[model samples]
Target: MPKTQPTIRDVAAAAGVAVSTVSKYINGTQRFSGSVEAKLKAAIDALGYRSNPLARSMITGKTRTIGLAILDIRNPHFTNIVKGANRVALQHDYTLLLVDTEESQERERPLIEALAQRVDGMIISSRMPDDAVQWLLELSKPVVLFGRSQQFPIASVGTDGHLAASMLARHLLNLGHRRIAYLGFAKSRWNDERRRGIADCLQKAGLQLDVHDAEAPSAIAGERACSAILLGSSQPDAVICYNDLIALGFMKEARELGFRLPQDLSVVGFDNVSYAEYASPALTTVDLQSEKMGELAMTKLIAALNGSHDDEYAMLEPRLVVRESTMRRPDTSQPAGVTEMTPKTAGGRRRTGGQGA
Candidate 1:
């Protein structure tokens, strides 16, 4: 009822070559004359022959697979990173094995350990503590850190969150926002970096930030934090969110509460995700070059697998993108003490004549 699968011996016989020659060709251990190559190809095609990857790996001592562990697969920022890493892996004729830790520290070690058994090396974007990550280095596999940098003797690639947040803070400060609030994520690995950047910038102007933390990084968490931020004793002129999803949620809830965007309050977010520009009034955010970080991390890991002993660290610069979500605050000394909301036409374009900062 079933036919036997062709083996290397069958291929060699069909091509009229030695079994060793067929092995060399399949393993890419040596080159052959064009005639021999063509004959081998024809034989393999006719027999529908396929080499066993396990057997080949046994002989070569390389699985030719790289494992990538991400904290959360739902985030578009991490998705872009995967795209960049997969691209480089394919170019090098290697397979990429992906695992999502679901932002859980408990899942990271077990997932990484299981992946390590099958792959040649790993690229980890983890939420685990630093000591826990340092423990992983003892696995004896080439490991690259993604999305964060450290003084550890491992290669790492990440975006400068502090610098990016500082830029956003400065942008809002220049807009005359005196009472600024920062909405942060409790589980974020770089939350302190972003918060510190915003705080440091505001301190220069003799102002302090009103800090609030969301239980999670999702839009739901952001939407839930809206009441505390907007209904508090001291209302801020502007709010800076941890990421675009949170910012979008905050804006939606703020509007539902009858506050006009940038008229009653201003909002800014980080990680200029794809939909950030397509939001109702668009979103002002930071570009962290997520894809580039992925590419660099994969490249560095592959380099280590090739016996290159150098440790490299790459920190990408962030760019600020301004959109309609933020605007200059009304001058407090004005006779009216507040600026009137500008009317928008039916097509949703604001009629001209608003004052600029």
Candidate 2:
């Protein structure tokens, strides 16, 4: 068996034509006279030739692969999104090259530049800074962002973070809780979206949100932020977290501070990540349709790759998921340590705290 793939030059030589002519013929963007086309076809067949994805990309400037830059692959939240992208990418015979920024734009920049040569397009999770984004845009490659915001102009697929936040706020307020706080991630589009959502929900209910930034969305960050919030002069009747990990961290810290769930405080988280249910009290959260968002993003990207220059953006809706972590305000007369909290609508109606209906 031949060890090495045949090169374009070899094809050109065999066909008795210049390499550029052969490349143009192969890419199908150039018109060739009848005799030249026939000769090239004959040479291709005789060489048992297949286009080298790498070499062809070098000549035609298209890798046919998409680069995916994720903040953290270890987090189930990001992985869930990737699963969706993978499904769609496979359907189009496209490969996804995943790179972790680890929440650092500086580290992410060089990685993106390195991968740029290997991919025709990029789907970014927004670890890049403004300068980097501007640079990427200037590079003139097709880019689709996962998180949406007015600040960025690239086509995007994002969850309805604002609505999700509002829903969570309203859920707690309807449970007869007067004091509620939001523990959210700071300095990101998703963070801002969720915060705006919370504000919207609070406004509709004639309530105000006590928003606190966790500095990080990681479990450790959640723990610290929760501790600080609980230690404050006034403890909130309920807490809403940026994501499930933060919620779980808050719960753990709240327990340490003798703040029992659904009794001393109700808690809700966003993202509804896998670990949300496995936590001690299980987290009440907003399902951001994360996986579905990923799927939709790739679908749009594929359409663009197939030569659609039309502008498209998608915002997946979110819904509240009632689990054990949220419920009606505790009976003041009763001592803490009760389990199982029921969910309430933003309008003060009781509902099951099971899976999302």
Candidate 3:
């Protein structure tokens, strides 16, 4: 009572050709004369024969699929990365299998292990420790790391977080923000690098950062951090968030708590996510070139799969984009009991009261 699907054999029989000829035509392994090509096409159309990808993969040992594992899909920064990787995958006729690790370290290894079995290669944006990543190399499948670089032999693509954060810290310092705070993501290596950059720059100017950690790199976590940052014993003149989502959350909570943007407080973030430019007053942030990172990672993975081992690590430079959310520190008095710091030059010399251009 059921109709059976046609196979390559059916097309070969209908075209009066050998089964190998049909296979070659279907796989594009050989080009035939125009008349032979026409005949095969006509026979394929008549029989409604479709090649089975699973069967072909069993024979060729290549699934023609790429696995992309990201930390959290809800973040626009990761979403843009996916777009760039998917574009390259499409161009190469490879299917992209996406998986979200949901920021779970425990899930990364098992998820990647399972995914690696069915894909030709993988691109991973993981929070796993470097030692844990070493195990992935044993799988024999090409893997390209996204967003973080390591000393391991695996290919990687990432932006320079330290440089990016250093630039942002210098910007805030130039704006006369002596009391600066950093809203960081907990347990993140990238966050550590950024904090170090900010701290290094501040230390050079004879100032230090007021550090706070968010449970996660999300708007809600950022909002929750407001209590510690704004209502703490000392209030900072400016806050640099780990990413745009956190910055946006902090801004929202700050406004609800009677603080005005760049007036009562100045705020900046990293990642330059789509929401950054569309926030109430727009946000000043660093551009990590997330999309380009994705493209490069995918490209590198593909190259590795093809036996090319050069360019194992690609690091993109970050750019700082200034917008409406940050401004020169207003000449206002500090909160009661909080010390006011005179703006200092990089060499530790105090400067007269004037904002940086």
lDDT of 3 by residue, 294-324 (tens): 8888899888878998545688988777777
lDDT of each: 0.83, 0.76, 0.84
TM-score of each: 0.87, 0.79, 0.86
lDDT of 1 at 159: 78
Per-residue lDDT over 232-257 for candidate 2, one digit per residue giving the tens place of the 0 to 100 score:
87778888888888788788888988
lDDT of 1: 0.83
- Full candidate order by lDDT, most accurate first: 3, 1, 2
In TM-score terms, candidate 1 sits at 0.87
Stretches off by above 4 angstroms in model 3 are 1-4, 14-16, 28-48, 331-357
Q: What's the residue-level lDDT of 113 in candidate 1?
A: 94
lDDT of candidate 1 over 1-357, digit per residue (tens): 799999999999999999999999998889999999999999999999999999999877789999999988888888989999999999999999999999787778898999999999999987764545676678889999865546468778887788888877877777778889999986677888999998987887778999999877778888999988999999998999999889999999999888899888889898778888888778878778888888989999988988887566788888777778998887743222223333223234322211111
- How many backbone clashes are present in model 2? 2
Candidate with more favorable, higher lDDT: 1 or 3: 3
Question: Which window of 10 residues has the lowest lDDT sum in candidate 3?
Answer: 348-357
Per-prediction backbone clash count: 0, 2, 0
Q: What lDDT score is found at residue 47 in candidate 1? A: 100
Sort the predicted structures by TM-score, highest score first.
Answer: 1, 3, 2
Q: Which candidate leads the pack in lDDT?
A: 3
Q: Which ten residues in a row have the lowest lDDT in candidate 1?
A: 348-357
